[model samples]
Target chain A: MNNPLLSIQSQYWAVRDYLSPEFVAAGDFLTFKFPVWQWEKGDPSRARDFLPHDKQYLITRNVPCLRRATAVNYTDADEDAEKLLSFLDEAEEVAGPDGKPRGDDDWVATHIGRGQLPYLRITPLPTQPLANLNIKDTADEQIDEIPDMDEIPDMDDEAVGLEEEDDAVRIVHPSAAEVNSTAGQNLLQVRTYDCLISYDKHYQTPRFWLYGYDEPLADSAEQNPLTPAQVFQDVPADYAFKTMTMEAFPHSGQQLASVHPCKHASVMKKFIDRMEAAQPTEGEAAPLTSGSKKGKWGIGGMVRKVTGGSAPPADKKEKEPSGDGEGSSGVQVDFYLVIFLKFIASIVPTIEVDSTTATAL
Target chain B: MAPLQFQPLSSQPTPSFWSALNSLKLDKLKLDDSEQPMEAWLEESREIHDREKGGTIGVSGSVGLGSGAFGQESGERPPAGSVELKGVFKNYNTIEEFKATETKKEIFNSVADSILASFETNAPQLDTFLLVTFADLKKYIYHYWFAFPAVVSKPAWEIEEGGLVAAEDQLVAEARKLADDLSNRSGALLVRGPAGQRTAAPVKDATAFFEGVPSSERIVAFHDPSHLPDAPGWPVRNVLFYLASKHGLSDVTILCLRSGSSSRIGRVSLPGPLSAEKPTFVGWERNKIGKLGSRVADLGPMMDPARLADQAV
Candidate 1:
């Protein structure tokens, strides 16, 4: 709803708007900084919101996934109950270090998770704007002009302000040794998700299909999309330790086989259940800080890992499965894997459970 | 347009749990085995089925039963007066049916009429009916199931490995508490019969099962239609009579979620007992069915295609 360069109102009742304005196409390379401060210093407070906030601007700028973004507001909630963002602007006011109203510079450096990083240099430079290409009227005007610092307020709530500029357009800081060192190399491990956006002619609705890959497929390979098998091939070889591979049972043309690691739902369920079992009647919080399992995969740990955008440490990797190792043909299939497989099957109806390689976990 | 108040961009990546998992290195990540509990539940269900029947009831019929078994086999069985469970309607190769110059619509219409007739004769009060399909109907059914508190058929796959039993078990426990608290007016409890039970036997037959239950109650029984034949013993019709003659309750409504005429995945058939072609059943209308479940909505977002294509930076 923020961008007014173009507006897309959905005729299909199923989908009213985009999930995030930042929907990108398959091959679009997005580079966001993963701060080494949390890893090196192990600062618990700094652990939260480690990922840069400016990544959204770099990703949402006229990518193929969102060519002409929808013009939505809180009032749009009347049409569909989901567009309630207008009323839910729950922003907490954070005072500056000086205990007074903060300026854009102080707010960006202190409040927003990134400590010393500038907003402009968050992601790699954008060569071109691809979002509003279809809007001929707006295409004539340059929309990326940096607003004056005084024109914007230093509030923590809004996505953009006058002080800082587009993340991709800004230059890297001279003093940031880590970023400067990795100038030529890929600092962030980029994962390109091949998204197929199409309108279901029969249902008169839009469909958003996503296939994750370690590498992007070539444009010529559009006809032959990467199968789950092909995608899993690119997954880190070490991941095979926790990977559960699925295949189509019966030979069907429209078949998909995926290799998804343990689902968070499954892990969280066990954690809660264990907690409840230990204290049958007590309404106390689960003691998640003690055990190795609880420390790594507990609800709090997972929230930190997910929200902080950090990976599990290599030294304390999850205990390997008790089965015949990663290459075992008759591997036990867990409930989460089945749900994941079912989701794959739902996408490709002909897909069947590869019973030969899977069993009850 | 509303006054656009874009926040200053920060240097953080979008927060996604699965994406984080996907990005994390494979080394230290632990994969908890969540399927063990559900597998145990399946084994437990099989055990209960075995114990209740006193033996492997209708072991021969479990694989398949011929046309004669519907009538003749029931009479020849032991003096226990057992009937065929008659809950599941196995999948038949609909190629012949489709190629016979006969419209499936017409066949479905006839079947619908027959089901409605059975309902009228037995339990006319069961007016509200819902027929949902399995397999390809997942997206469609899930969209609506979020809104309505209707009986959902727990497929064998879901029960065995998808942690559905735990959810249903919780539902049963909650229902039991409510039933005890308000003794007279409690909702029905959905119970599983057996995965492949073809005979009523003495144990879980419709009559005996209902006679034991308190008044004003119903139990939802689900079966995989892949193993069933497209014949007289349709799953929906059988449940209608089973609940009606056994309990003689006013709420005779039946909702059936089954596979298609053929075992091939995309095809789905919602065999209705009273009325199959309700406004809610046939179409894949998103406005009507967009009330997604909490878990499902949390699964991911469904963005509009135009919005995805929007080029605005």
Candidate 2:
């Protein structure tokens, strides 16, 4: 654990070949390449100021993708290859105009290969095999269980049994860096446990390559499997590439059908039908409520009245008592007889009738 | 009757008058062949002068009479009484001393307020007033003094020292050396006479000439309501009023230039002719336009009728 910072610095040096001089100069001014999170904290207002205001720090992981050997070779052999070569050569010529070439220049030459040399190959570690190697197998008998744990079954034995049940399962742990200063003069400490078995150089490029892996001997050369010419040589052009032309899918025609069949059409249709049935018939009106007229009252007026907390004034109430005979219980009464008796008493032309009525009573 | 003592025997008796006597004398000497020569008459006049010791009057009296007669001979009338009095007394007395008075700080503040009020009352609101002050009448005099010659004559610096001459005799002699130097240095000489002449008119009163120049170029006055009077060396109040009257600038702002400092602090809005309201005053301490949290004094229309009516009683 060389402070981990040194390792990070070395990683920066490794990728320095890819960066421009201006970028390197900028990096020299900055302590490190700012992470995206840190970059986002930059305030535009203080941009005019010399110092950056944001103090928060962030770390970012760097993962390099390897260029295929065939692509590199093709690019070199092609007519346009001279352009790329010239650019690289010009970059090299300008690298150390007055002094010896820096380490980055050497690294660039090695990665891209100098003159007629082959390009570097990179392969990532076989994660599955490495993880499997970490699992202990107690069934081998050479593995012994802990003497104090009679109640507890051997964990190694259980892990081996579980591995048998699902070969994909594995336990993983961090590995130490594989420093090989004697073999290579380079200061970088390569991780040997994570190294891949793939060849470092091939006549044709690999399907996928990771940076920094095993080198193959010159005598063990084999036919490249990942070349496009080799992979598609037997198939017809249309089938091999799957042509997607405008003529095949014209604008006037319906949109191209999905390659995967739609399984839920019937369910969708049922739902649509149910929704259509639930829709109201024409001319049917919606029911009105007190809330519907709330807008007319307005928030201010409503708040005033509600907060006042008093029954509405009698005059303010619009409901009036009805004069019709209908009441709490509807009862038909002799309105004509009552009116006639009142008339007989008020005007004595009705007095004779009133006297006769009294005698009859 | 007196003439009878000398020679009374003529039958006409000299007609009892000089004409008769002169006729008798003419008869006595009668034998005319030619007119009398003017020389004899002149001799006789000389004889009379000699006898009278400078004619009937003394030499001084005769000289005085002669000068008086010459004076009376000219038809030009004397100046009217009031005009003469004005020229001889009033104008001569006070023209040099006439100058604008120094307004009190409080009066300036009030003026600023009034100008602001006027701006609020009027339309087409004015925003700012730029006041340029001269130290005193001297500076104002200098500007006009320099400007007049620059306008009227060929630049004095353009003319050679001896080659250039002024039109007026007074200036010619009085500023002879100055004119020469001015001419050599390409200075302007305010020559008079006709457009192209050797003679130049006498220089009029410089102050009056300055006062007569259009006020626009000489002074720019603006009334800003928001200007503070107490601000050092800041003539916010006076400037506001001057601009209001001079430029008819309403709602003009007054900026205070601090003493020993070029920075502006207080702003006064001068009211227009139509405005009678007070100008809004804001100090530099209240707001900084360039810096954060600086307050700005906003003096817009003060009494907007519509806004006033819109307010609930």
TM-score of chain B of each: 0.24, 0.16
lDDT by residue for model 1 over A2-22, one digit each (tens)?
222112222111132222221
For all predictions in the order shown, the interface RMSD in Å is 28.9, 66.7
Can you give the lDDT of residue B202 in candidate 2? 17
lDDT of 2 by residue, B146-237 (tens): 00000001110111122211123332332333333333211112222222232321112112323434332221111111111222121222
Q: What does TM-score give for chain A of every model? A: 0.21, 0.15
Q: What is candidate 2's fraction of native contacts? A: 0.00
TM-score for model 1? 0.23
Q: Residue A63: error of model 2 in Å? A: 29
lDDT of candidate model 2 versus the reference? 0.19
Q: Taking the candidates in order, what DockQ does each have?
A: 0.01, 0.00
Prediction 1 global C-alpha lDDT: 0.21
Error of 2 at A297 (Å): 83
lDDT of 1 at B114: 43
**Candidate 1 chain A lowest-lDDT run of ten:** A60-69
